[model samples]
Target: MESLVGLVVCSLLLAVQGLYSPSDDVVELNASNFNREVMQSDSLWLIEFYAPWCGHCQRLTPDWKKAATALKGVVKVGAVDADQHKSLGGQYGIRGFPTIKIFGANKNKPEDYQGGRTSQAIVEAALSGVRSLVKDRMAGKTGGSDHGWQSGGGGSGSKKDVVELTDDNFDQLVLDGEEVWLVEFFAPWCGHCKNLEPEWAAAATDIREQTKGKVRLGAVDATVHQGLSSRYGVRGFPTIKIFRKGEEPEDYSGGRSRSDIVSRALDLYSDNSPPPELLEIISEDTLKKTCEDYQLCIIAVLPHILDTGAAGRNGYLEVMMKMAEKYKKKMWGWLWTEAGAQMELESALGIGGFGYPAMAAINARKMKFALLKGSFSETGIHEFLRDLSMGRGSTATVGGGALPKIYTVQPWDGKDGELPTEDDIDLSDVELDDLERDEL
Candidate 1:
């Protein structure tokens, strides 16, 4: 009887262990249903391409489930056991365990999640995806086609800013176009084309407004317009081409995300505007003006030439500029002053005792500031900024400390010793060394 009881107890324990399940919020996906459920779905999907035996995937499971729960209706979260669904994993080029890919409107072109592995990071990414979905839907509902008539071309119908191109109108609007053009060549039956419709439409609205209608976004139905498709050598489902007034049609090889497309369009626009200026903290008045900008301001207190000279300071500035370029999406302001130039600012930020090349991010409205504790390299600064953006950085109140008194100094020209003023540089009477003698 005792032996029989022991056997029953062991069986019960095994059953309990086998019954452990993942969160119901996360949909279990496989190779058979991947196309029907993911490729054809209208909702945005955040799928985890993970392996069961991977320790990293196991660790990420909890956070993934939590994010799914939080974004329950806003976004759809799914996971595939890559070890079992090898075909599906191989289809999407998944070579790593626990790879997270965000399938926005464009299902074929998913964006990789490279942010932190924390629950907050997952939630933030999901929210961004949700925003994209809503924006795309808005474009579909309110958008109109350029064909001057209502014709349903693909999934979710036509869009407002996406001009429908044809064999007849392609030359007049695209070839002889004065403004820059971004055209998408697609087919109705193609799954990838269906996915790209929403993203393309949403990006079109933004690009149109941003470029003030100078850059037009259009689409071509490759099947309906066979002449134009054959002429462009369009063999793919969704081939994007750019057309400028005097340039050949250039292929757009960038990512299909709304942000990526918008960024690339702005680059093509090339308005020749200067990047955000790095202000010099010349006086208390300048500090007041800088702090009033509502956005987070990064303040750098660096060594004077007497300590590390201009080379060292310029090198630090270069690092700051690189970081600024990388994170231009955040719209942050950069400012700097010599170590001793702003004594009160240094004291408030505690950078004077921390040595040269110290950095701190300030929120003037909240009267709180967070100082950088790591190296001043690009990666270090990126991590710091990332933490602050995520609200993870430790901050302190101003505590009634007096504002810093700043000394007036010329802007850095990335040169050693005294910089030449504007009046010192001359262009008059300078002969062109590369001039060629031409007979009239």
Candidate 2:
């Protein structure tokens, strides 16, 4: 029996090791050799910028190592402790604790790692990046200078609004500046850069006026600024990076049109605002006004619990606030009401028939709504909204084809229920004498 128990213990230990073991093949990179090991290497590299104290990094550590072990030879997996190697982290514009970057053939322009944290997901993304690198290389040798990615290989000349950045001025103007910058890294002979010239100039002008200089747009001549080009890993003709004051730069992977750039800039510039207001749908006026004000409105019908008092309402509101913050970039409106408080709205949404913590997104103009079928927590709400943004979430006509009549209730004062002060007891007259007699 003792031998059997020992055997079971050993098996459990092995299971734990299987799940958490670090890969011996995962290269540990630091400031000292980052350039030699990653930027100049012939192999494709996926590097994770991590901090020892980050909870997410800790959770991802095992999976990252497992992915490294799986992709040992085909691709190189590496990690950098951003906390310890601050200079290297800053150079890459790593603002977050655990950012992953994919370095392909064009070692200068690494793609952001935005996939799932699972080993399988990481491996898939790495393979995809490698494939893209291979395709770009196979496209041709000197074609980048002749045809580029677009028609005109030469620029249409410089514009005034778009700041001209060179290696000498880039650091002073962008990397070390107080303002946020959206910079385009481009080769002057590249056709795509030439095409982007007009759009970029227009966006710069609009962004400057709208943001009042809080966000600026700049351009780098990759051919001239060899140092900056190599440092940023700019393998492509036109690459964009967003540099916020004192933060690591983020790759701008959004659409390249003028409107898209302006929209994304506004989103980033408004990053300091409070999470979109999570208002209570007290009356018809409030509901109508909120829906009209924002392009999309997320409404939640939460539990009404006077027994647990305002604490329950506050807890639900907290969840909404967090979700709102996570999606602040979308500029969506967040509103909530107690379950059963807005009966007409609830019926329209088909909520009370289900349960508390039900959520729906409304495009008031379209008179369409999408129900949230998943958990109402942060991740679930994020997934739902992401689908909606991508035009994937299914929508139905709002019941009644109009906004529901919402009645007002006492807004939560955000405090626990109070006990009424009792009148001074008659025991004030008799309690003292009884206690003295009993003691005697």
Candidate 3:
């Protein structure tokens, strides 16, 4: 009887362990300790908002554990059952099952993980995030004064990205400039302004890097530049305003965290940027120039004009154009070639056997390429690119380990294809009847 009781106890322990034990690599996060463990900590975190009953989340369990183990020392991996912790999931706007977010330098703003669901992809993305954080630190784009803002008037050499606006140049820089500006009217003596100085400066640097100077952050001394402050109706200690070229200055009403400010600035940048142009691969120069200029070139080989007439071809082009706009921030080059137009190019990219509307993403510098195996729709393309970006997709070395020779070809005429005219054959010279008689 004692032996049977012992066996029952062991079975119970095993069942409990299957649920979640201390040996589990992934930290189980909940409302009780989430803020203290993740938000307040400086370490990078990859958190998954999952539902306990979700099949997809269950399937991802082993891979998530493996990733957590691999990133043991580098990145912290955690999971929260969003179904049980509805408030926490709702806080981050988690609407789907197994949604992952990376909490890096700015814990207040966790970025959505659009990478593959596999362990390798998770590890690559986490390491990439760590590298970015380290780079920013080395560049002095982070950190703040432990004690309040320094007394050095206006701007510092480290905060060069944060432009100093004066009453004299305010109109010229903020109102007249074509770029989107986030201006802060602050008094040097105000404690709140002092506290916001470092956050604002850090945000400015990140915004400048991401937007390529299309969006700017500036500050003004409300006490010294009273006229400028009064003009914008600055009544508070540190009032922030958004200034566009022609639109009236609007109040900046977002969170004060660095991530919040940077996120808002990026949105403004995207709104200002025009949709990326889709070019046709007309010659060697066209292919070389476009591919070399961007990190990745998305090349598509659509069906021949005879197969899919002008209307069908245009429909495919529209899909590409929409995807180009969606991922315009990646700065990838988009080009399309008619089927059988560039034989060498197709051979190098291994796109011949693939029916029509085939796509391949090439990294020219690395001489690597990943072919699209899914449908040529928006969803399929988005998943393919997202996996490639996170280093999850399988890639092959470019044929000949270099770009193939591209034959110069005429551009598509946007019209249906026509068969070449054949010359008439005059066989009336009696060859058929005479040959039959001779053979008989």
Best by lDDT: 3
| Candidate with maximal TM-score | 3
Write down the TM-score of every candidate: 0.45, 0.46, 0.56
lDDT of candidates 1 onward, in order = 0.72, 0.75, 0.81
97: Cα error in model 3, Å: 33
lDDT of 3 by residue, 275-327 (tens): 77899998999899888877789999999999999999999999999999988
Model 1 regions more than 4 Å off = 1-182, 186-199, 209-216, 221-228, 235-277, 283-295, 364-367, 378-383, 389-391, 398-440
- Name the runs in model 2 displaced over 4 angstroms: 1-179, 184-196, 205-214, 219-241, 248-274, 283-285, 378-395, 408-410, 418-440
In angstroms, the error of model 3 at 259 is: 7.6
lDDT of 2 by residue, 391-410 (tens): 55456667899998878788
Q: Which ten residues in a row have the lowest lDDT in candidate 2?
A: 142-151
Q: How accurate is candidate 3 locally (lDDT)?
A: 0.81
Query: Candidates sorted by lDDT, descending order?
Result: 3, 2, 1
lDDT of 2 at 263: 64
Answer with 2 or 3, whichever has the higher lDDT.
Answer: 3
For model 1, residues 1-440, the per-residue Cα lDDT tens digits are: 22354355434423332111553788888755665677567778889988664568878988888888888988888998876665456456575778999887766457898888888999998888787678877777422223221246444422667788888898999889777888989887788776676657766776777667778889888888889999989999899999987678899998775545666777766532334567778766677777766357888887876566677878888888887776665556788887777777777776665677899988775566778888889989999999876546556655365345656666666556554467565646655552333321
Which pairs clash inside model 3?
none
